[model samples]
Target: MLYIGVDLGTSSVKLLLMDESGDIKSIVTREYPLYFPQPGWSEQNPEDWFSALTDGIKELTKDCDKTTVDGISFSGQMHGMVILDEEDKVIRPAILWNDGRTQAECDYLNNEIGRDKISAYTGNMALTGFTAPKLLWVKKHEPENFAKIKKVMLPKDYAAYCLSGVHCTDVSDASGMLLLDVKNKCWSKEMLDIIGLKEEQLAKVYESYEVVGTLKKDIAKELGLPESVKVIAGGGDQAVAAVGTGTVGEGMCNVSLGTSGVVFIASKEYAEVDQNALHVFAHADGKYHFMGVMLSAAASNKWWQDEIIGTKEYKKEEAAITKLGDNNVYFLPYLMGERTPHNNPNARGTFIGMTMDTTRADMTQAMLEGVAFALRDSFEITKKLGVNIDRIRINGGGAKSPLWCKIIADVLNVKVDKINSAEGPAFGAAILAAVGCGKYASVEEAAGKLIKVIETTEQDPVIVAKYNKKYDIFKDLYPTLKTMFDRIAE
Candidate 1:
């Protein structure tokens, strides 16, 4: 049997085809434009995503026997607000998870609404990236558009709706919306009331690996597949990626350094993890997970390499860096503001301690280390929750960099394992599809059979000690510049 995994990403929709045994058959990607209507505001037309998803599916399954495709599922960018009218027409461009234009609404939720009360209701602090704040922003600033919201879904759920004709979302993705009462696995009525939204506007929730609906006849015929093809409820990218990496059981961990970075620790219960709370999200495995997110990870390097350096020779540029944990320069990877520890939307990317003697390699190394240190900030929080993590399964675009992987190993003082496939989210989506199709007994079994660690980057004791001190300085920089970041935004 074959399954399809559609990863609806920020810049592209990546589709993967795999067998029941987890062998990848084919892969295809379709790119789409991202819009920045204003600085710090990010948006994408849901129509563009739907087009990419459908077109990519056709290309992805062209060589295979379409009848054998048992299921299709998704792993998508979470927390994006995709609102639709009564007729299901998109009301506006989706407010992407990386967008920082909802600071005012986040402030209102965290302060006027009271953090303690909001946390009690949703198990998360209101962050600018969350869907609720984006909704509040729209309601306050664009009331006309807000009034048209008849159903709301995350990025992937939109594609699910297009395929299966079901207005539905999975627990993992909805947890990021700041509207789900995560512990209870339901929408928080308090949050709905706060946003002045009715329950009918939201999608029906499901577990990530559950079968939500079958393919619509029209969509199935268009994609050269059967209407009997099951539409599985795949998950938010991070949770599903954890499944792909075998991070399903309690205390198992996966760190993703994709467009965004996440330090994800899978848990079985919904209890509070720490004083920081550390982003308590519903896991794709029908449980819970604690996550710490950075808005920019490989994206920061992509900007430096593509937009600024004018080259895609990332490895060639990385080859220039001979120093590890020894750079004088420091970069704050806040190109899209921050989320994890310092929920600061006003934060801007900064390069400090640069001198005339600073080489491109030094600055490059700083960018890499800066992201590692930021992830380490989350690792610290997980440790505070008494979660013992000695090794982590690492996957993402940044995981392809040997230097960056080694830096992550030393910075976190743990073994970083690289799996066979770098397509974490897409692969995980396939696993969810497999589980939904009864190809595997459970997600854990599917992951265990499929994911193989190809290599491990062992931590260097000397570099680890060096980074321990460097991280101390790195953590302080954000706090020191908080007031300045706020002032500059004004």
Candidate 2:
């Protein structure tokens, strides 16, 4: 049997085909244009995502027998607000998760509504990216559009609805919306009233591996597949990636250094919100997980290489850097503000302690180490919650760098394990589809059979001690510059 995984990303739609044995048979991607009407706002057309998926799937399955495809699932960008009218037409281009225009709405929730109440109710505080804030933004600014909202959905759930004729979302994805009472695994009535939305506007929530519905007859015919092809309710990108990396059960960890960075840790029991820093959400593995996000991870390095250094050869630039923890330069990796510990949109990137004697390699190493230290900030928070994680599975573009991997290992003082497949969320969604199709009994069983740790990077005690000192300095820079960042953004 074959399964299809759709990674609905910010810049493109990536489609992957995986067989029952976890081999990637074929993969294809299609890019779509993103619109920025203002400096801080981000928007995209839902039609573009649909078009990309249909075309990419056609190309991906051209050589294979499409009738053999057993299931389809998705791993998508979370917290984006997608609304449909009474006629099921898109009310407007989706307000993307990364959009920062909901500051006023966020203030209303965090201050007036109060963070303590929100945390107690939704297991998270109001952030500018969350769906609850976006809804409030529309109600205040675009009241006309607010009244026209007959149904509300996330980016991937919209695609699932189009394919299966079902309005549904998995628990993991719904947790990010601030509408679900995460601990009890149901919608929070208080949040619904606060957002001025009814329970009917929400989609039916299911476990990540549960089958929502089968493919619609017309969609199956168009793709030359059987209508019996089940559509599984997959999960948010980070949650699915954890399952793919076998970061299931208690104390298991997965660190993703993708376009955005995340530290995902699974726990056997429900953990409450702490300082509104780490996200408390439902895991795709039928458990609970805590996540900390940094808006810029690999994108920081990409910016330094392409926009600053004018080079596409990242390996070549990093190859010259041999120094690990002795660099004099320090980089604050806040190119896109920050998320985890400090939810400051006004924060800016800075290179501190740079001198004339600083070499190119020193600056490069600082950039890598700066990201590692920032990740450690979140790791510190997870420790405060009494969740002790000693090892983590690593994925994403930055995970390919040996030096960066070593930096992360020493800085966070945790074992870093590299898995065979680096497909992240898309591959994870495919595995969930396999589980839903009965190819595997549970998510943990599927991962145990499929995920292989090819290598492990252990922390060096001496270097870890050096980084421990460096991290204290790294942590202090953000608060010290908070006033300056706020003034400059004005």
Candidate 3:
């Protein structure tokens, strides 16, 4: 049987067709517009996503026997607010995960309500990107729209609901909403009440690999597939991406360097870190995991190359950076504020310790090293929680660079393994579909059989020592500039 994985991303919807043996048959991507109504606010039309996926699926399965398709699942951008009216129409453009318009709501949750109380309720402190804060913002500012809300769904769940006619979400995606009692795997009544939301407003939560419903008759017929095709409740992009890279089971780690960077560690049991710096969330494999997210990773490099340096030749520019740890210049990768340990929206990108002799190559190398050092800040928190991560699986655009991977391995002092396939969240979603169809016993079993490691980057002791010293200084820059960032923002 065949399975379909729909990765509903911020910019596009990617559809993947895979057979039961894990061979990818076809892949199709369709891009949609991302709207910026204000300087820091991000939004997208839910209809655009569904339209893209529907058309992409038709293109993806054109040459194949559509009747053979057994199931479909999703992996999507998390924490976007998608609300529907009583008639099931989108109430407004979705507030994206990258949107930073909830600062006031976040401050209210963290300061007025108290971070300790919020953390005790949801196992996380309020952040500008969280769904609960966004909902609060809507209630305060767009009260008319809030009064019409009948359903609340995440980005991917909106697509799932459109296809299967079932309102559903999985544990991994719900964990990011700040509405889930993450440690208990249920909706937090206190959080819902605080936000003036009821439990029924949310989708029914399921494990990532569990079946949500079958395809709607019209949707299945429209896509030239069987009506019996099951729809699996998938996971958040990062959690499902972990499944794709075999980052399941205890102590397994995966470092992603896409637009945003994440250091994900799978755990056998729920564990909370100090100050709630690292997110404690449910894993796709039915266990628990911790994740530390940095808002800008490859994005910083893109900004430098495209906007600043005016070049698309990333490889050519990186090829000039030979002296890795020897550069005197240092960069702080806070292009879009920051998350993880700092959680400061006022932070700005900075290039410190530059001199008259500083070359473009020196700055380039510093930018790469800066991202690695910031990831280490998150790793340090995990270490404090007593989670021993000796190695990590690396994916994303930056992972394609050997120099960047080497820098990360040495800085973190952990083995970095490069996988053969970089399909990421889409591939992981297909694995969930397979498991839901009984092709595999569980998500872990499916991942173990599908994911293959191709190369391993080992840490050099000499390089590690140099980066350790550099990281010590890099960690101090954020604190030193915190007040300045706030003042400038004001």
Candidate 4:
């Protein structure tokens, strides 16, 4: 039987067709517009997502026997607020995960309500990107819209509801919402009350590999598929991407260098780190994982290459960056503020130590090294927690750059393994669908059988030493500039 994985991303929806054996039959991507209504605010029309997915799915399965498709699942951008009215209409544009309009709400949650209590309930502190804060922002700023809300869903859950006619979300995605009692795997009543929400307003939560429902009759007919096709409860982008890269078992790590960079380490049990610095969320594999996310990773590189350098030749631009750790130029990758270790939304990107001698190559090298160093900042916290991860599977667009991969390996002083397939969340969603259909016994079993490393980048000891020195300097820049960032924001 075949399975379809829909990766509902911030930029596009990518549909993947895979057989039970894990071979990818076809892949199609459809891009949609991302709206920026104001500075630091990001929104999207949820309808655009569904439209893209339907079109992409038709293209994805055009050459195949559609009747053979047994199941569908999703991997989606986490923490976007998609509220629906009583009539099941979207109340407003979705407030995205990258949106930074919830600072005041986050401050109220962390300071007024208390971070300790929030952390205890959700296994994470309130952040500008979290759904709870976004909900508060809506209630305070858009009371009329809040009054009309009957259901709250994440971006992909909205799509699942459209397809299966079931309002549901999985544990992994719900974990990022700050509405789930993550340690207990249920909605937090205290959090709900605090946000002036009721439990019924939230979607039913399920495990990532559990079946939510079958396709709705109209959707089935529209897609030319069977109504019997199971819709598996999928996961958040990072968690499902972990499955895609085989980061399921205890202590296994996967580093994603997508728009945002993350250090995801799967753990057998729940373990919340100090100050709730790392997100301790339920994993798709029915386990737990610690995640450290930076608001901008490959995005910093994109900004530099596209907006600054005025070119799309990423490879050619990166080719000029030869001296990895020896450059004096330093960049702080806070293009979208930051998260993880430092949850400062006021933070801004900075370039320091740039002299007249600093070439475009030197600044470009700084941007790449800066992202690696930020990831290392998260790794440092994980190490302090005694999670000894010596290697990590790397994925996402930035990972495609061999030079950037080597820099990450050297900067983190760990071996980086490149998988044969870089499909990330879409592939992981298919694996979840297969597991939901009983094609695999468990997520781990499916991942171990299908995901394979094609190449490994080992850290050079000499380069590691050079990066260690540079990273020390890089780490200090953020703290030193924190006050300035806050002042500038004011």
Candidate 5:
């Protein structure tokens, strides 16, 4: 039997067909528009995601045997607020996960609501992107629309609903919403009370690999697929991407270097407020995971390459950056503010230490090294929590750069494994689909069999020591600039 994994991303929806043995049959992508009505707000239409998924599925399964497809699942963008009315029509454009319009709401949650009680209920403090804050934003600003919400769901759950006609979400995806009781694996009643939301307004929760429902007959027929295809409860992009990179069970680590960077650490047992710096969320494998987020990662590289240098030849520019540790220039990668340790939405990206003799390569290298140092911030938090992760599987656009990979391995001082597949969340969703269909027994068993590390990047002690000193300086820059960033924003 074949399985379909749909990666519902911020910019596009990617669908891939894979056999039970983990060989990919076909992959296709459909891009959609992102809207920014205000400076800090971001939104997208749910209808766009549904259109893209259905059209992409038809293309993904065009040459394959559609009848043999046994299951469908999703790896979704997390924490987006998608609401539906009683008749199931989208109330408004979804408030995207990257939208930063909820700073006021976040302040209320962390201050008025009290971070301790919030953390006690959800195992996390509020950030501007969380769903609870978004709901508060809607309720305070758009009371008419807020009262009309019959259901609230994440981005991928929206896709799953389109396929199976069931309102459901998995634990891993729900963990980011600030509405889930992470330790208990259920919705937090206290949080629901605070938000003035009913439990029935939320989708039914399921484990990541469990079957939510089968495809609706109309949806199956439109996509030329079988109606009997099972819809598996997949996970958030980060959790499912960890499964794709084979980062599961205790002490396993994975770092994503996409538009936003994340340091993901898995644990079989949940920790009750180990530290407030990193987010504690339920993993897709019926366990828990810790994540430290950076709002900008390779995005910093893209801005420097495209907006500054005016070129799409990333490798060509990277070829000039030969040095690893020593650079006079430094970059602060808070282009979209920051999360994790310093949950400040007022932070801004800055460049310091440039001199008359500074070269373009030095500036570029500083941008790359700055991101590495920021990621190290999260790694330090995990270390403080006593999670001993000596190696991490690397994925996303930045992992393609050997120079950047070497920098990351050296700066973090860990073994970096480059997996065989670069499919990321798409492949992990497929693995979940396989497990849900009973092609494999559990998520870990299927991941162990299908995912392999083809190459590994080792750290150099010499560079590690240099980065340690540089990182010390890097950490101090953010604190010094905090007041200035706030004044500038004001």
Candidate 6:
């Protein structure tokens, strides 16, 4: 049998087709426009996602046997606010995960309500990107829209509803909403009351690999697929990406350097809040994982190469940056504010320690090293919890850069393994569909058979020592500039 995985991303929708044995048959992508009506705010129409998925599926399965398709699943951008009326029409353009319009609501949750209580109820602290804060933003500013809301769903869950005629979400995806009791794997009534929502407005929660419903007959007919095809409850992009990298069993680690950078570490049993800095969320493999995120990763490189240097030749520019950690110039990678360690919305990107002697190569190296140091901040918190990780499987666009991968390896002092297939969340979603369809017995089993490492980048002790001294200095710049960032923003 065949399975389909839909990766609903911020910029595009990517679809993948796979056989029962985990071999990919074909992959397709459809791009969509992103709207920015104001500074620091991002929005997208959810209807575009459904249309792209339907069209991409048709293109992906055109030459293949569509009748053999057995199941479908999704890995989606998390924390977007998607609402529906009584007739299930989209109420407004979705507030994207990167939207920073929720600073007031976040301050209300973290300071007025208190982070301790919010963490106690939701198992995570409030950020500007979480669904709870987005909900508050809508209620305070768009009162008319809030009054008409009949249901609130995440981005990919909206597409699943259109395909399967079910309103549901998985625990891994719900963990980012700030409305779930993540430690307990259920919705928190306290959070619901705080957001002025009842249980009826929320979708039913399910495990990531469970079957949600069969595909709607109309949808199947339009795509030339079987009506009996099952739609499984999948996960958020990060969780599913972990599965694709084979980071499923206890103590496994996966590092992703996409638009955002993340470090994922799996645990055999549920762990309570530790440090409360890193996210403690349920994993798609029916266990638990701790994750740390950097708001800008590969995006830092993109901004420098395209917007600043005026070039699309990333490889040519990076080829000039030979020096790793000895550059005098330094860049604080806060282009999108920051998340993991800082959690400061007022923070802005900065360049410190530049001189007349500094070259473009020196500044470029700083951009790469800056992102590495930020990720190391999160790794320190995980170490405080007594979690030890020796090596991590790396994925995403940044992972394709040899210099960046080497910098991450030496800075973190962990070996970085490059996988043969780095298709991101779309491939991961397809693997989840295969598991749900009983093509494989368990998630671990599926990953063990599918995820393959093609090469490993080992950390050099000499380079590691150089970055270690530089990281200590990088950690101090944020606190010193915190007030300045706020004052300038005001």
Q: Judged by lDDT against the true structure, how good is candidate 3?
A: 0.93
Predicted structure 1, TM vs. truth: 0.89
Please identify model 6 stretches exceeding 4 Å from their true place.
37-40, 272-275, 306-329, 354-360
User: Candidate 2, which segments miss by more than 4 Å at Cα?
Assistant: 305-323, 354-357
**Pairs of colliding residues, candidate 6:** none
Task: Report the Cα lDDT for residue 198, model 4.
Answer: 94
Residues 1-490 of candidate 5: C-alpha lDDT, one tens digit per residue: 9999989999999998999889999999999999999998899999999999989998999898888999988899999999999999999999998898998998899899999999999999888879999999999999999999999999999989988999999999999999999999999999999999999999999999999999899998898888899999999999998988898989999999998999999999888645478989999887999989898999999999999999999888888986788887899999988876788878999999999998989989999999999999998887777889899999889999999999999999999998889998999999999999999998999999999999999999998999999999999999898999999999
lDDT score for candidate 2 against the true structure: 0.91
What do the candidate models score in CA lDDT, each in turn?
Answer: 0.91, 0.91, 0.93, 0.93, 0.92, 0.90
lDDT of prediction 5: 0.92
What is residue 189's positional error in candidate 4, in angstroms?
Answer: 1.0
Tens digit per residue, CA lDDT, model 2, 255-351:
9988889999998789875688899999999999999988889989998888987999888988998767788789999997888889887889989
**What does candidate 4's lDDT look like per residue over 197-254, in tens digits?**
9999999999999999999999999988899999999999989989888999989999
- Please provide, for model 3 over 1-490, each residue's C-alpha lDDT reduced to its tens digit, 9 standing for 90 to 100: 9999989999999999999989999999999999999999999999999999999999999999988999999999999999999999999999999898999999999999999999989889988778999999999999999999999999999999999999999999999999999999999999999999999999999999999999899998898889999999999999998998899999999999999999999998997778989999999999999999999999999999899989999989999988766888889999988888888878999999999999999988999999999899989998888889889999888888898999999999999999878898899999999999999998888988998898999999998998888888898999998999999989
Q: What is the TM-score of each candidate against the true structure?
A: 0.89, 0.94, 0.94, 0.91, 0.93, 0.92
Candidate 3 wrongly placed segments (more than 4 Å) = 305-313, 316-323, 355-359
Deviation in Å, model 5, residue 340 alpha carbon? 3.0
lDDT of 6: 0.90
What's the distance in Å from true for residue 240, model 4?
A: 1.4
Q: List candidate 1 stretches off by more than 4 Å.
A: 36-40, 142-145, 273-277, 299-336, 348-367, 480-490
